[model samples]
Target chain A: MKRLVQALRNVERHYLLLLAPLLVFVVAIAIYPLLFSVSISFFKYRLTDPTQTKTFLGLANYITAFQDEQVRKALANTLVFVFGTVTTELTVGLGLALLLSAETRLMQFIRSWLLMPMAIPPLVVGLVWRSLYNVDFGVIPYYLKLLGFDLGRGPLGESATAMAAVILVDLWEWSPLLMVIFLAGLKSLPSEPYEAARVDGANRWQRFIHITLPLLQPVFLVGLLLRTMQSFKVFDIIYATTAGGPGTTTTVLNYHIYTVGMTFFNMGYAAALANILLVVVAILSILYVMVLEQRQL
Target chain B: MHRKSSRLAFLALLMILALLATQCAAPPAQQPAAPAAPAGEEASQAPAAAEKPFAGTELVLASMTDQYVAAFQYLIPLFEEETGIKVTLDPLGYVDLYQKLTADFVGHTGNYDLMTVDIVWTGEYAANGYTLPLDDFMERDKDQLALDDIMPVSWTLGEWEGKHWAYPLAGYANVLNYRKDVFAEKGLEPPKTQEQLLEYAKMLNDPENDFYGIALLGAKGPAVAQDYMVFVQQHGSSILDENGKPAINTPKNVEILEFFGKLFDYAPPGATDYWWDQRETAFRSGKVAMMEGWSIARAGYENPEISSVVGKVDIALAPVAEGMEPKYGFGGWGIGINADSENAEAAWEFIKWLTSPEIQKEWIRHDGAPIRRSTLEDPELNQEYPWFPVLLESFEKGDGDYRPRIPEYSIIQDALGTTVNAYLVGEMTAQEALDQAQAQVEAALK
Candidate 1:
């Protein structure tokens, strides 16, 4: 007992003790459910079944997912959403960061105000934008009508514009996050390189391309990876606004999983689809890390 | 060392998304358990009357926040005052109510002692035994229930294979609400046939003046799916064949789909995105000259606060196919006791009292829909509502099975929900859309 107490008193042992609660919490709250999801993905489990039967199907659910046309279309939509939102947010966020990099009270206030969109829930944002996009009563179409643009079906009503409209809502909500991240990167950037470039007769644009862009590559990677993962899991906004419509144009993978799991109560299939999404996200994340690391080297 | 740390960072990121993935895939565990009436107060204020047998027994009722929830808000307090059974009301929107009550049942949490079941969910709930089969209680109390007073079609709200999984709570019939003033100005009459409806819609539509012929439920999911099913009912086409197997891709259904899509030409451009509320807004705001909707909403048009077309609206039985027999689409809510609830007796007491003819009069006065013949024919209510005759006629000829209240009903709704909207948005041809919907439903059944 004395030896055990002595071992427990060791500094490394104390550190383990400090982390034990959080470790337990993470395992219980995160790891268990994940493992449970993986297990269920191999079964045929209909949540509404009175008997609560679990028929083991091995790889059948995943196989079925590949065969399902809805799954393929949803996957395509998710990729489009991730690609559209991340690229636009990165470009616009970078521009906004550059413009507001100066230390001024007014700029500071505007920066705070810009974050208001992020603070509101995505579902609320989608609903407010849905009304604003209404062709008959919405302000957007009304203004467009005044400008003599014939909006045959409003932005959210047409398949051609539905995906883009949802992407714009995502952009409006998340761009401020990227701007904050880039602003931090900009602030931390070494001033010595800019000074050296200025002494070498580099103009503002030239200095930006040569010095700023190169240094901000790491920050860009961070922003891109974060948004890409979040965009893959988009649900609330889609649930609130389009509900995968304008003919499945806005139906992303996450929303499809929701329909399968919650609406249809087909738990096994839903879990399989979610695992597929996770794998896709994981592979993309790995590729992003490798590419960024190679560039840095 | 750098490779190890980078891998660790990658694993950390995986954990974050893994958490989200599980949350996304799994049924939610959290119950939105509203705070119940304080147990301490219930004990202190327990009624002394011997009649209050279930006094101090608290129950939770999950209800859809349809207009009728107002009646619940008004009546629940009175019930508590008399019976002393404290009932907490949790009002949820349509989709949320369905999903939440479903989670409660599947998890066997009994978070809700009672819930309002949509007519379409009768099959699924009964098949799963999520709700108590109420036939036994009905048999025991038939004398007091005045079983004869309930209209025959109202039984469709909860009856499955001769068992009552729920008791009919609110009954609605599909009816057409047209602007009488506009119809008079155009020298037209209310449409009695589907062909006439289309003709009158086109004639009245004037987009240059920001007015359209009709407002519709065109957004995807249940809104568009149920609206389409209403037309299927009106046209005397069944989503299922005579054998009760899904046959959504029939040539007749395809033609109906095409005709349904054509109505969009005369609706507001954004009508293709309108859900129930937006469609109601279009009519109430005087932007549409006509809207075919539930009889439940007819009364709201005369309430000037939400409606600009007060006293200008008149309702008729929804139009049927030119030569088909007139059978209005019937749908509404049924109050069911959760099978897992420990307070089933108290819950049944509440239902009996609420649906009684005496209280049902107060129910309609406070915006509740009617299930009883006496309540629908009440002289005073007739004077107040005035549209009850049309509703009575529609109910007498109502067809509730038009949407197929089967265990696989949600699957059918979901399939049609997507494809119908897909057809409306020109993503797929009518034949292709129905074929896809049929394929989807068949696959789900497997």
Candidate 2:
């Protein structure tokens, strides 16, 4: 009981010491702005209006944003991009990680090289891909033409394929980070289970299916959750590549908030839109965590 | 196993050290160098400022023009030398400048001694006394400041509800861009009227072969709103009636919108996505034979790597619509002083040298877009750069053009863009699009 008391006192001291500074910082920078924005979302406020009062209009701004077709389109685009990129990246990244785990001498160097894209600024990566996707001067078209296919013009900014192109850029830039994490987990895995499976006369494929898959579940689920969250909040790549063009086909939820609030100076509407976006992301994150946790168990 | 654990610890330590290095190097690396020199005072002459009347005072003048940064920095030395006031120039882009100034107004900070404000932002800033009156500065320094020498209209853009808020700086307009080489190759002539321009666009287009006849802004924002206003004006319709009431939908306006909507057929495939740079890029790449854009694109077109028909590119007056009047775009910017300035007198001294006829002349030579009536009308100046004189003549003759002078202009523009882009992309008929936009704007206006 005396030991327990000392342990509790130690835990309490450390908690207060760490919690005070972190809470203060969070309240000033993150929580304060978040709450302030929520309050502002209920008003009719103009950034430039000096004398006009920010008249309280409960839920009017929220209703207007919800009814906006542009907002709906942006929300739809965001969902499509997040799901499309996250699933593909997770699968491809896991596949690459497994392939990389059985590698020979250059495996470490190859692993490091694969991380180059992640190291680059997302905006620069978007710009490089923008050039690669350009119809007239891009190498993407050249290679496709070599294989007898024409991808058409201005694909990144075009209405038919802009959202897809944004997803492609995000996948290209972030898939490597997923690979690194999975590879780390794969390298650290014990060999005893696999040896036991082999002793039971299990084939390579069966061993991988029965042992490897089940063992890698924790790492795989963690990767999925991280990728999904990151993909949902993707902005710099979309902004750089498309700026949401061709009748707003590429206007993701974040981009919509930016245009409506920052560009148009509709702070109240933007705040409402941001809140909706937060709710959406929060719901997706919850689902992601639950599924990952269930899979781990 | 012990070594492996130690290696993991080493790798973790390396990452920590890398992060620490990054955090240490980040701040000074990101802070934009506060404008390197004061406006209008040449930097080399700052040492001589100690002898002048304003010896001990400090002046900070801000302007928005990275394009003319080199030329503006030249004045820092001379102005500091003659005025005995240390001057600091805060240079930024149009959008950034607006946000900063607006935020300053809200905070009532005297951060900037002389601030660069969009002349139209004058009413709110000036009326609220966030900006200082320049009348006293002008009167006291008559020998240095020359208002009569500046373009009258460009100068008046600084005035709001009958108060002088800014001095004219750089002025240019969105004009019709046509390629002389393409016209000759295609055996077509420049359009004299808006109807003819549309017809020419149809003829010049060959989209299947990777060529667009023209490029136009289809997005909503300042850009689309500005272009829509110009298009409507060219066809003889005004967004705001002379009484300053919302008046966007009329028969003539509907016809104009329909004409532009149909013209979309000849524009680039993703033309609705293009902004000023994209339009310039498309035209420069020779993907489009003609485009309606800002007048200063003559400089961009001059670049050999970009333009497919640089040597063959030529300029002509924009095609007038059915009316004889040309619907010129409100496409220029001016400068103003912040009212909360502590060193207002010293800043005014620097502003004089920056906007004076002599400095304006030098700017014309350097900046490509200087705003002064004398610079615009000089025949000798026209003889050197042929486009300058022609643009000046057009600026002199241009009339009946305006932007949304209201603070709520951005909302109206958003409504305009949503409707215009929807129509251009074939979502709705021209009449329907205009009606929807008009309705949305009117509702927002209330």
Candidate 1 segments whose C-alpha is farther than 4 A from its true place: A1-17, A284-297, B1-49
lDDT of 1 by residue, B43-100 (tens): 3354536688899999999999999999999999999999899999999998899999
Worst 10 residues of 1 chain B by lDDT: B32-41
Q: lDDT per model, in order? A: 0.89, 0.69
lDDT string for model 2 (B1-446, tens) is: 54454444444433444454444533231221122123223323345455575776876666776356666677677777776678777887666777777666555666777766554465556545566666655555566666676665676456666656666666776567888888998788888788988888999899677787877766434555567677776776777778877677777778888887777678875566566666677788788888876675676577687677767777766777866565465456556666666565566666677777776767666654667777777777777667775576557655423666565565666677666766665556778877887887776656
lDDT per residue, candidate 2, A150-269, as tens digits? 554357645667678778888888889889888878887899998898899999899888988888888887787788777767788876776665446777889888876765566788
Candidate with the greatest DockQ versus the true structure = 1
TM-score for all models, in order of appearance: 0.92, 0.82
Q: lDDT winner among the candidates?
A: 1
> Per-prediction RMSD in angstroms?
5.6, 8.2
Candidate 1 fnat reads 0.54
Report the Cα lDDT for residue B120, model 2: 49
